[model samples]
Target: MVKGKATLALELPLPEEGTANTKQERAYQAIREAILNGLLQAEDRLPSTRALAQRWGVARGTLESVYERLQLEGYILRQVGSGSRVSAVMPDSYLKAVIDFGVTSTPIGEVPTSNPTESVRSETVHRAQVGMPFVARLANPQLMSPAEWAAHLQRAMARMTPDQMCNAEPQGALALRQQIARYLRNHRGIACQAEHLLITNGIRHAIDLVARVVLQPGDHVVVEDPGYPAVHRIFAEAGASLVYAPIDEQGLDLSSVPEAVHCRLAYVTPAHQSPLGVIMSATRRLELLDWAQRQGGWIIEDDYDSEFNYHRAPLPALKAIDSVQRVVYCGSFNQALFSNLRLGYLMAPPQLHNQILALWHTVGRSVGVSEQLGLAAYMHGPAFLRHLRRARQEYLTLRDIVLDTLQKHAAGRYRISGEHAGFHLILWLTADQDQDLLIEAAAEVGIRLQPLRGYCQQNQLEPAFVLGFAALTRAQAKTASLKLAYLLQA
Candidate 1:
């Protein structure tokens, strides 16, 4: 008889009393067959040993052996509190079975780990939408060459001594930090030592850490209206009372912020604000800094996608001018290099450095050592600069093509902004057109139009679409624009 805990919700097939193999083998084969047939899906939790044993009319000890074997063979994942789940990356036979079923799977949205195989089937289908092009989706093909990257990885691994591997610092490898320091000083004009810098998984992780270190429950945090939606969620999860600040042509409008609420932190994407591509003016940047200094608050300068400015020389980061160290600068390679490389850095004020470090150790430690070192090598090498130059030029051509197409085809129907920098631009739909209906029309014509309203928290802003042209070639953009123009005209 099965013993100990009560039964779980997981259902499992039972074997007959007089089976050829032992009850244990019968259960194993049944579960294995279920997985191979795609009936037992990946990440599916299994019935507890006690429950399964009771169902099989076998000893709980017998069921334990079966589960141990399956776990050893990489059939399922076993964790302390979470129970067992089917492994996401299955064996070749399981993958073959999935392929035979005529199904396809795409791993969604930069979670982490080895890319799940094309044959690997997930319960949820993540169909590709139109907004993917405008976003920093993936790394360039030329930059991700296996041969070249392997060489860099080899060099990075060789550079790591045995002692360097252990006692891994929560901040990051000093060597890599030094390289990042030099790169930032030369490229972004934000001067900082290795001590002020802390490597994070990405911008989101950095924001989470900052929230943990600086924010308390119900503390006010200022976020841009119609901003990156993810930022709103991050601060909210940290127990912040969010106050929305609207954006103008000069970037985040400080005038819009309510004076009654004392904000402890202000998050800004000054270099290139997402959805609205306005560069914050020098005067506005100074004003923002002054407010932070006066309020005794911190500014998270998200310098994402600042590298691909086309119209003029990129403006210096707010951190560059922050003599008072009120700015906590954040940058990520996900936009510059690839989305999968979730490597980003946080530059904190010296006063908050130790607190941030403490919070990181508790919540955000265990950054991939190889990735840090590999990125360090790539940054130090000539390829980094060479790739940037090529990407900048290519994006410029694509941007011009998009601008010309919109002006020629959809003119008078929409207002465009964000042409100054970044891979995307905003097209505000005029005449109070229904954004949902227009987006559906674009999709029908094989054009993916990202709705601007989706980014807004308060829904007080005008309806717009953020069009991304960087990923599309001249021909692709031209074709897509033709379809979009036709719909807009009607």
Candidate 2:
């Protein structure tokens, strides 16, 4: 009955202005916009008939008519004790659709999701519609334009011949590995060959494979303090000690790299640093490679969004710059194609390839061989690069919309970073700000964004969040920005 107890959400997704003919419909749109815009969110008890009527400067009956309209649209549910509570969002079928498109033919539950770090959000909720928006990986897995890739996908399916179905190559389809290698060499400037590439069931498998190969229990690993925490969790489960280092404006500050570096593995998003969005300078990249090579350490390069740079083409991947062969390069089709695709790869030097592949065989358990063939076909056929071109444009447009909206809406309370590439961005709250409390406040009104606090290391730095823009339409981004701004203003 009171806003005191409930989850915060964005103001509801509203119908557009002037789209509905009746006053009730118009009022419904208004209230819906408020909810979608985060002006009104879940469990925030609505004003009574008289209060709503007075606030809108409308007759009581007219307000009644509007509330009734919202109820009919399933925007709110009324109960005896709880006068009117915002309705949970209607689940979109994109997640299910992607699942059906043949990634993990054996349902996810059957496989146990390989990685233990998958939370309620990763498993149960596929598309992040309105709750605690995570910025590291995109929430909307179906973010790729299927219609655009329809031709490429068709080529892939055709390539999935019965011969491909009969056998499972532990190293993945040879053709696919070759395709990936060519793509990397041509696009990222990384020198890879089919011999070094191992395909697995997405990033989880790739990360797990890396963990199994490089890290021993209790081994120390250097992790960026404000980098993706989900990753740190994986390394921990693998029994590694995560040594935290703060990320600065110029990418992660390695100024403090210990002379006696103890970690066996170090993870960095050097191309466009996660959360911070700054590109690592070529000089720093050389130093980092040198440090790892000298220490006999392995660098886990999560080239998450190296393919989606905005201001310029992405920097050469660390793997490309390395003569030392210390970089274990990993990436996925999750960002470019879809999340549930479960298609990611790890490429290591020939020296470490067997161990990495053995880890892949041990942990991956099963691979989506058919999808790999399809992806290989897509990559080689005329459609792959073409699809990427269109995707880049759409993704960039959405990013611009996000920037414009944040600039227009979150004027005083927020500062955005890491905007040049990737699916998400980071917003650093003012020094005096309380992100935890502010996140709760945001929920009360209906806008859900991840607070940066969860991503930080023990008692370090100010709070910030990683947020994705690829999943939202430009219009929705604008509305979300406005909603977020309202919360900040409050």
Candidate 3:
């Protein structure tokens, strides 16, 4: 008899009477199960509490309890005059954003945390959540519930030996590089032999290694404005002068890039651009390649979300399009796979493999043999692809759930940006309202979010957030969404 039940269900025969005292509880359970199972669509109206009670033969008071629980769970919406509706959000994206928060180099004490699990989750704790996740860009692999990835890691580790860790982890650990290579081939269209690949800590380290070999102080590099801050920051730290290009729907506006930042480097997220979530069109991809070749600038193609592309099979990474050795295409399993393992590689100019290996030797020092070995074993083994496929499916489910639920409950008031692909979603802030108040209210409701303000370049800009989904369970995602929708009303 919960008031939040969806109106468009198949109308199964009502449950038998007397099994539960409070028919409202029974109603809530049924409706919640229906929503979780995707039996209802977004914007689907719900029967009033009275109507639901009549259907279940429960008193309206009992029905009220059911509605309260649904609201708490973020599975339903309630209004003074409006009826309750479904909650929406991208759970998998939120999970990844939580994990990535840890990958970047941040001041240690700056991250707030009392709970170890959350401490492990945010790169910085007390990190806010909401429509502003792009600004936060916090992705936490550690936050991924171990219970979920255990079976996959277990299968991969079953084959490992103690001696493996004792030995020096190779250029690309036989198992992991191979596993990674295979995935890149199948998913992102990265073509390379396992031997040619050099596994490193994460994409940042990989980028750093490349920076070491290819970039020198005063080097001019073109980057996207409002692009991945990590990329620009790293290059800037390495003494590279950057020409920041404004990004439009077509991707990075090369014209906006000053001629001065025209050294051999440019970083681009082609599948879905970071923060803004714009995919690079084919024409723009070729134009970028042409620009790189003509200017002799090295194009660092970041294959961040090509794996989870919702629009179509992912575009072949920009490296695949290179006839010249201009594309230093880099990607990592960190985003697609869980963290706790630093497994990512770069597909470089064929001649630069040895130089890249040499650079890793001097710069990063070493990566874990154990993680590399385990991930490799998974990659080579049948289960590796299976795990990816499973995650891929679940990520889509999480994305759809978030998008559908938000559209259902909030409608035109709150708008969602980004694509159906990727582990995270970006919600644009149309107004500069009291974002802090909104976030605080969300916490009061027991749902959490990271605001986009943290990801902003400076105070002069508006706010946004990079909500992740890889860690959150479907149930958790649904509950989080309902709480978020209520907050949106404020």
Model 1 clash pairs are: 130-448
Badly placed stretches (over 4 Å) of model 1 are: 1-143
* Candidate 2: 10-residue stretch with minimal lDDT: 104-113
Question: For residues 9-76, could you state the per-residue lDDT of candidate 2 as single tens digits?
Answer: 21233345555545555555566555543455555667666665555555778767666645533456
Q: How many pairs collide in each candidate, listed in order? A: 1, 15, 51
After superposition on all CA atoms, what RMSD does each candidate show versus the true structure?
27.5, 22.5, 17.9
lDDT of 2: 0.66
lDDT of 1: 0.71
How far off is residue 26 in model 3, in Å? Answer: 53
Report the poorest 10 consecutive residues by lDDT, candidate 3.
104-113
Which regions of candidate 2 deviate over 4 angstroms?
1-162, 363-365, 431-434
Number of the candidate with higher TM-score, 1 or 2: 1
lDDT of 3 by residue, 1-490 (tens): 3334355532634455553334644575577546544565345567777876666666878778777665543456688777877653223322232334322221111111122122111233233232232222233343344664566467656766777646665486777667666676665545667776777777888788778777766666677756666666678677766665666766776765544334567888876787667766544665676566556557787876566766545655667546455678787777666653566788787656789887777665566665666566556656556655676777677677777777778766566677556767877555845667776776677655666544434223455556775456677667676667666765
- How many clashing pairs does model 3 include? 51
- Between prediction 1 and prediction 3, which has the larger TM-score? 1
